[model samples]
Target: MKNFRREGNSNPVPAPSGGVVAGDGVLVGSLFGIAAIDAAEGESVEIASVGVFEMKKTSAQAWTVGAKVYWDGTNKVATTTASGNSLIGVAVGAAANPSATGLVRLNGVSI
Candidate 1:
Protein backbone atom coordinates (compact mmCIF):
# COMPACT_ATOMS: atom_id res chain seq x y z
CA MET A 1 0.00 0.00 0.00
CA LYS A 2 3.03 2.24 -0.04
CA ASN A 3 2.40 3.38 -3.60
CA PHE A 4 -1.32 3.66 -3.23
CA ARG A 5 -3.17 6.64 -4.61
CA ARG A 6 -6.77 7.65 -4.64
CA GLU A 7 -9.22 5.56 -6.62
CA GLY A 8 -8.68 6.28 -10.32
CA ASN A 9 -12.28 6.24 -11.36
CA SER A 10 -11.87 10.01 -11.48
CA ASN A 11 -8.77 12.18 -11.73
CA PRO A 12 -7.64 15.66 -12.57
CA VAL A 13 -6.07 16.29 -15.95
CA PRO A 14 -5.31 19.34 -18.00
CA ALA A 15 -8.08 20.43 -20.27
CA PRO A 16 -7.22 20.27 -23.92
CA SER A 17 -6.91 23.32 -26.12
CA GLY A 18 -10.27 25.03 -26.68
CA GLY A 19 -11.29 23.86 -23.21
CA VAL A 20 -14.07 21.41 -22.36
CA VAL A 21 -17.58 21.69 -21.02
CA ALA A 22 -19.04 19.59 -18.27
CA GLY A 23 -20.35 16.28 -19.59
CA ASP A 24 -17.97 16.44 -22.56
CA GLY A 25 -15.83 13.44 -23.39
CA VAL A 26 -12.10 14.18 -23.40
CA LEU A 27 -9.01 12.21 -24.31
CA VAL A 28 -5.85 12.92 -22.33
CA GLY A 29 -2.95 11.07 -23.91
CA SER A 30 -4.50 7.60 -24.26
CA LEU A 31 -6.96 7.94 -21.38
CA PHE A 32 -10.58 8.70 -22.14
CA GLY A 33 -12.95 10.22 -19.59
CA ILE A 34 -15.88 12.52 -19.12
CA ALA A 35 -15.33 16.03 -17.87
CA ALA A 36 -16.64 16.41 -14.33
CA ILE A 37 -16.91 20.16 -14.76
CA ASP A 38 -16.03 22.94 -17.17
CA ALA A 39 -12.36 23.86 -17.25
CA ALA A 40 -10.25 26.17 -19.33
CA GLU A 41 -7.54 24.87 -21.59
CA GLY A 42 -4.48 23.75 -19.66
CA GLU A 43 -6.33 23.92 -16.34
CA SER A 44 -6.74 20.86 -14.20
CA VAL A 45 -10.16 19.37 -14.65
CA GLU A 46 -11.72 16.46 -12.86
CA ILE A 47 -12.69 13.68 -15.23
CA ALA A 48 -14.69 10.57 -14.51
CA SER A 49 -12.70 7.77 -16.07
CA VAL A 50 -15.17 4.99 -15.40
CA GLY A 51 -18.91 4.92 -15.26
CA VAL A 52 -22.05 4.51 -17.33
CA PHE A 53 -22.71 7.81 -19.04
CA GLU A 54 -25.09 9.06 -21.63
CA MET A 55 -22.70 10.34 -24.26
CA LYS A 56 -23.09 12.05 -27.55
CA LYS A 57 -22.85 9.69 -30.48
CA THR A 58 -22.74 9.96 -34.23
CA SER A 59 -26.33 10.71 -34.93
CA ALA A 60 -26.25 8.93 -38.24
CA GLN A 61 -24.88 5.68 -36.90
CA ALA A 62 -26.95 3.06 -35.14
CA TRP A 63 -25.46 1.11 -32.27
CA THR A 64 -26.17 -2.32 -30.84
CA VAL A 65 -25.70 -3.55 -27.31
CA GLY A 66 -22.16 -4.77 -26.61
CA ALA A 67 -20.74 -3.04 -29.69
CA LYS A 68 -17.35 -1.51 -29.12
CA VAL A 69 -17.45 2.26 -28.82
CA TYR A 70 -14.72 4.61 -29.81
CA TRP A 71 -14.23 8.25 -29.08
CA ASP A 72 -14.19 10.51 -32.08
CA GLY A 73 -12.31 13.35 -30.45
CA THR A 74 -12.37 15.50 -33.52
CA ASN A 75 -16.13 15.31 -33.70
CA LYS A 76 -16.61 15.15 -29.92
CA VAL A 77 -18.90 12.20 -30.26
CA ALA A 78 -18.97 8.45 -29.60
CA THR A 79 -18.57 6.25 -32.68
CA THR A 80 -18.43 2.61 -33.64
CA THR A 81 -15.73 3.23 -36.22
CA ALA A 82 -12.33 2.13 -34.99
CA SER A 83 -10.23 3.89 -37.57
CA GLY A 84 -8.68 7.09 -36.21
CA ASN A 85 -10.74 6.72 -33.07
CA SER A 86 -9.81 5.81 -29.50
CA LEU A 87 -11.47 2.80 -27.91
CA ILE A 88 -13.39 4.03 -24.90
CA GLY A 89 -15.98 1.45 -23.96
CA VAL A 90 -18.96 -0.63 -25.05
CA ALA A 91 -22.53 0.19 -25.85
CA VAL A 92 -24.77 -0.86 -23.00
CA GLY A 93 -27.98 -0.42 -24.95
CA ALA A 94 -29.19 -0.33 -28.53
CA ALA A 95 -29.22 3.07 -30.14
CA ALA A 96 -31.32 3.98 -33.11
CA ASN A 97 -30.10 5.92 -36.08
CA PRO A 98 -30.43 9.69 -35.77
CA SER A 99 -30.24 9.48 -32.02
CA ALA A 100 -28.08 12.12 -30.44
CA THR A 101 -26.97 10.08 -27.48
CA GLY A 102 -26.12 6.54 -26.42
CA LEU A 103 -25.48 4.78 -23.15
CA VAL A 104 -21.84 3.75 -22.68
CA ARG A 105 -19.82 2.02 -20.03
CA LEU A 106 -16.41 3.66 -19.91
CA ASN A 107 -13.57 1.17 -19.96
CA GLY A 108 -11.13 3.87 -18.69
CA VAL A 109 -8.28 2.58 -20.81
CA SER A 110 -7.63 3.69 -24.35
CA ILE A 111 -7.14 0.20 -25.74
Candidate 2:
Protein backbone atom coordinates (compact mmCIF):
# COMPACT_ATOMS: atom_id res chain seq x y z
CA MET A 1 0.00 0.00 0.00
CA LYS A 2 3.05 2.23 -0.22
CA ASN A 3 2.09 3.67 -3.56
CA PHE A 4 -1.57 3.88 -2.71
CA ARG A 5 -2.97 7.36 -2.62
CA ARG A 6 -5.98 7.85 -0.41
CA GLU A 7 -9.12 8.62 -2.28
CA GLY A 8 -11.13 10.62 0.17
CA ASN A 9 -14.88 10.59 0.06
CA SER A 10 -15.01 14.36 -0.37
CA ASN A 11 -12.82 17.19 -1.65
CA PRO A 12 -12.21 20.70 -0.38
CA VAL A 13 -13.45 23.07 -3.04
CA PRO A 14 -14.04 26.80 -2.92
CA ALA A 15 -17.64 27.79 -2.42
CA PRO A 16 -19.53 28.64 -5.57
CA SER A 17 -20.57 32.16 -6.53
CA GLY A 18 -23.76 32.02 -4.49
CA GLY A 19 -22.09 30.14 -1.68
CA VAL A 20 -23.10 26.61 -0.63
CA VAL A 21 -24.83 25.02 2.29
CA ALA A 22 -24.78 21.48 3.59
CA GLY A 23 -26.24 18.91 1.18
CA ASP A 24 -26.46 21.39 -1.67
CA GLY A 25 -25.44 20.32 -5.16
CA VAL A 26 -22.71 22.36 -6.81
CA LEU A 27 -20.73 22.53 -10.03
CA VAL A 28 -17.05 22.77 -9.18
CA GLY A 29 -14.60 23.22 -12.02
CA SER A 30 -15.51 20.48 -14.50
CA LEU A 31 -17.00 18.28 -11.83
CA PHE A 32 -20.65 18.24 -10.79
CA GLY A 33 -20.67 17.43 -7.14
CA ILE A 34 -22.50 18.04 -3.85
CA ALA A 35 -21.57 19.96 -0.75
CA ALA A 36 -20.81 17.62 2.11
CA ILE A 37 -21.22 20.35 4.71
CA ASP A 38 -22.01 24.01 5.11
CA ALA A 39 -19.37 26.57 4.19
CA ALA A 40 -19.13 30.32 4.09
CA GLU A 41 -17.15 32.81 2.09
CA GLY A 42 -13.35 32.71 2.44
CA GLU A 43 -13.48 29.05 3.39
CA SER A 44 -13.12 25.74 1.60
CA VAL A 45 -15.84 23.12 1.87
CA GLU A 46 -15.94 19.41 1.25
CA ILE A 47 -17.72 18.28 -1.89
CA ALA A 48 -18.69 14.73 -2.54
CA SER A 49 -18.56 13.65 -6.15
CA VAL A 50 -19.50 10.02 -5.68
CA GLY A 51 -21.95 7.73 -3.93
CA VAL A 52 -25.75 7.61 -3.93
CA PHE A 53 -27.83 10.56 -2.83
CA GLU A 54 -31.53 11.20 -2.45
CA MET A 55 -31.89 14.06 -4.88
CA LYS A 56 -34.92 16.08 -5.73
CA LYS A 57 -36.74 15.18 -8.96
CA THR A 58 -37.76 17.75 -11.48
CA SER A 59 -41.47 17.27 -12.05
CA ALA A 60 -43.18 13.95 -11.37
CA GLN A 61 -41.17 11.85 -13.75
CA ALA A 62 -40.82 8.10 -13.84
CA TRP A 63 -37.32 6.72 -13.60
CA THR A 64 -36.02 3.23 -14.27
CA VAL A 65 -32.86 1.42 -13.48
CA GLY A 66 -29.84 2.48 -15.51
CA ALA A 67 -31.60 5.61 -16.70
CA LYS A 68 -29.23 8.44 -17.39
CA VAL A 69 -29.62 11.06 -14.69
CA TYR A 70 -28.80 14.71 -15.02
CA TRP A 71 -28.41 17.47 -12.50
CA ASP A 72 -30.64 20.43 -13.10
CA GLY A 73 -28.53 23.19 -11.64
CA THR A 74 -31.16 25.86 -11.90
CA ASN A 75 -33.85 23.81 -10.26
CA LYS A 76 -31.49 21.79 -8.11
CA VAL A 77 -33.21 18.61 -9.10
CA ALA A 78 -32.39 15.37 -10.91
CA THR A 79 -33.80 14.59 -14.31
CA THR A 80 -33.38 12.18 -17.22
CA THR A 81 -32.95 14.87 -19.82
CA ALA A 82 -29.55 15.49 -21.36
CA SER A 83 -29.86 18.80 -23.16
CA GLY A 84 -28.55 21.70 -21.09
CA ASN A 85 -28.00 19.49 -18.08
CA SER A 86 -25.07 18.14 -16.12
CA LEU A 87 -24.78 14.37 -16.30
CA ILE A 88 -24.61 13.10 -12.76
CA GLY A 89 -25.10 9.36 -12.90
CA VAL A 90 -27.66 6.56 -13.39
CA ALA A 91 -30.83 5.75 -11.60
CA VAL A 92 -30.22 2.89 -9.23
CA GLY A 93 -33.91 2.03 -8.96
CA ALA A 94 -37.29 2.74 -10.48
CA ALA A 95 -39.62 5.48 -9.41
CA ALA A 96 -43.14 5.90 -10.66
CA ASN A 97 -43.79 9.59 -11.08
CA PRO A 98 -41.54 10.51 -8.25
CA SER A 99 -42.80 13.66 -6.61
CA ALA A 100 -40.08 14.74 -4.23
CA THR A 101 -36.90 12.73 -4.35
CA GLY A 102 -35.24 9.70 -5.95
CA LEU A 103 -32.05 7.74 -5.57
CA VAL A 104 -29.24 8.70 -7.91
CA ARG A 105 -25.84 7.11 -8.18
CA LEU A 106 -23.44 10.03 -8.56
CA ASN A 107 -20.28 9.27 -10.53
CA GLY A 108 -19.12 12.91 -10.79
CA VAL A 109 -19.20 12.64 -14.58
CA SER A 110 -20.63 14.39 -17.59
CA ILE A 111 -21.25 13.60 -21.24
Candidate 3:
Protein backbone atom coordinates (compact mmCIF):
# COMPACT_ATOMS: atom_id res chain seq x y z
CA MET A 1 0.00 0.00 0.00
CA LYS A 2 3.02 2.30 0.23
CA ASN A 3 3.00 2.79 -3.53
CA PHE A 4 -0.69 3.47 -3.70
CA ARG A 5 -1.80 6.88 -4.90
CA ARG A 6 -5.17 8.54 -5.18
CA GLU A 7 -6.38 9.27 -8.67
CA GLY A 8 -7.70 12.76 -9.38
CA ASN A 9 -10.94 13.54 -11.14
CA SER A 10 -9.36 16.34 -13.15
CA ASN A 11 -6.52 16.57 -15.67
CA PRO A 12 -4.13 19.36 -16.62
CA VAL A 13 -4.09 20.57 -20.23
CA PRO A 14 -2.90 23.51 -22.26
CA ALA A 15 -5.14 26.47 -22.58
CA PRO A 16 -6.85 27.33 -25.84
CA SER A 17 -6.74 30.66 -27.69
CA GLY A 18 -7.31 33.76 -25.54
CA GLY A 19 -6.41 31.62 -22.56
CA VAL A 20 -8.98 29.95 -20.29
CA VAL A 21 -10.62 31.02 -17.07
CA ALA A 22 -12.29 29.17 -14.25
CA GLY A 23 -15.72 27.93 -15.32
CA ASP A 24 -14.78 28.29 -18.96
CA GLY A 25 -15.77 25.52 -21.34
CA VAL A 26 -12.73 24.03 -23.05
CA LEU A 27 -12.57 21.53 -25.89
CA VAL A 28 -9.33 19.62 -26.24
CA GLY A 29 -9.29 17.24 -29.19
CA SER A 30 -12.41 15.08 -28.70
CA LEU A 31 -12.62 15.94 -24.99
CA PHE A 32 -14.97 18.78 -24.16
CA GLY A 33 -15.17 19.88 -20.53
CA ILE A 34 -14.83 22.77 -18.04
CA ALA A 35 -11.84 24.41 -16.45
CA ALA A 36 -11.51 23.75 -12.73
CA ILE A 37 -9.51 26.94 -12.21
CA ASP A 38 -8.00 29.88 -14.07
CA ALA A 39 -5.08 28.99 -16.31
CA ALA A 40 -2.92 31.07 -18.60
CA GLU A 41 -1.58 30.02 -21.98
CA GLY A 42 0.79 27.04 -21.88
CA GLU A 43 0.05 26.50 -18.20
CA SER A 44 -1.18 23.22 -16.73
CA VAL A 45 -4.48 23.32 -14.86
CA GLU A 46 -7.13 20.96 -13.69
CA ILE A 47 -10.09 20.40 -15.97
CA ALA A 48 -13.15 18.68 -14.59
CA SER A 49 -15.00 16.27 -16.83
CA VAL A 50 -18.14 15.92 -14.77
CA GLY A 51 -19.91 18.56 -12.67
CA VAL A 52 -22.76 21.03 -12.56
CA PHE A 53 -21.76 24.38 -14.01
CA GLU A 54 -23.50 27.60 -14.83
CA MET A 55 -22.52 27.80 -18.49
CA LYS A 56 -23.06 30.39 -21.15
CA LYS A 57 -26.05 29.65 -23.32
CA THR A 58 -28.03 31.09 -26.19
CA SER A 59 -30.16 33.42 -24.13
CA ALA A 60 -32.79 33.75 -26.83
CA GLN A 61 -34.16 30.28 -26.23
CA ALA A 62 -35.45 28.42 -23.21
CA TRP A 63 -34.22 25.10 -21.82
CA THR A 64 -35.82 22.15 -20.07
CA VAL A 65 -34.39 19.73 -17.56
CA GLY A 66 -32.74 16.64 -19.11
CA ALA A 67 -32.56 18.31 -22.55
CA LYS A 68 -29.40 17.50 -24.41
CA VAL A 69 -26.93 20.40 -24.60
CA TYR A 70 -24.22 21.16 -27.08
CA TRP A 71 -21.23 23.46 -26.71
CA ASP A 72 -20.91 26.07 -29.40
CA GLY A 73 -17.17 26.61 -29.21
CA THR A 74 -17.20 29.49 -31.64
CA ASN A 75 -19.71 31.48 -29.64
CA LYS A 76 -18.90 29.88 -26.30
CA VAL A 77 -22.55 29.34 -25.59
CA ALA A 78 -24.57 26.24 -24.80
CA THR A 79 -27.46 25.64 -27.16
CA THR A 80 -30.12 23.09 -27.92
CA THR A 81 -29.17 23.35 -31.59
CA ALA A 82 -27.32 20.22 -32.63
CA SER A 83 -25.90 20.25 -36.13
CA GLY A 84 -22.11 20.22 -35.96
CA ASN A 85 -21.48 20.92 -32.28
CA SER A 86 -19.83 19.01 -29.45
CA LEU A 87 -22.05 17.35 -26.87
CA ILE A 88 -21.22 18.98 -23.52
CA GLY A 89 -23.98 17.74 -21.23
CA VAL A 90 -27.60 18.13 -20.24
CA ALA A 91 -29.62 21.01 -18.81
CA VAL A 92 -30.32 20.44 -15.17
CA GLY A 93 -32.27 23.69 -14.85
CA ALA A 94 -34.48 25.67 -17.20
CA ALA A 95 -33.56 28.90 -18.89
CA ALA A 96 -36.81 30.74 -19.31
CA ASN A 97 -35.37 33.08 -21.94
CA PRO A 98 -32.30 34.88 -23.20
CA SER A 99 -30.09 35.59 -20.21
CA ALA A 100 -26.51 35.57 -19.10
CA THR A 101 -26.14 31.82 -18.58
CA GLY A 102 -27.77 28.52 -17.69
CA LEU A 103 -27.07 25.49 -15.55
CA VAL A 104 -25.52 22.41 -17.20
CA ARG A 105 -24.76 19.03 -15.74
CA LEU A 106 -21.47 18.01 -17.36
CA ASN A 107 -21.34 14.27 -17.83
CA GLY A 108 -18.08 14.20 -19.86
CA VAL A 109 -19.58 12.57 -22.96
CA SER A 110 -18.18 13.27 -26.45
CA ILE A 111 -20.14 14.22 -29.51
Give the local distance difference test score of model 1: 0.95
Write model 2 residue lDDT over 47-84, tens digit each, in one string: 88889988778767999899999988888789998899
Q: Estimate each model's TM-score.
A: 0.97, 0.85, 0.86
Candidate order by decreasing lDDT: 1, 3, 2
- Clashing pairs for model 3 are 59-98
Cand. 1 TM to true fold: 0.97
Those runs of model 3 whose alpha carbons end farther than 4 Å from true positions after fitting are 1-8
- Which 10-residue span in candidate 2 carries the lowest summed lDDT? 4-13
The sequence of per-residue lDDT tens digits that candidate 3 reaches over residues 1-111 is: 898565544667788878898988888886777888888887776788787889889989799999999989889889888988888889999888867788998867558
Q: For each candidate, what is the lDDT?
A: 0.95, 0.81, 0.83
Query: Candidates 1 and 2: which is better by TM-score?
Result: 1
Task: Point out the higher-scoring one by lDDT: 1 or 3.
Answer: 1
| Candidate 2, superposed: residue stretches over 4 Å from native | 1-5
Clashes of 3: 1
Clashing pairs in 2: none
Q: Enumerate clash totals for all models, in the order shown.
A: 0, 0, 1
Candidate 1 regions off by >4 Å? Answer: none
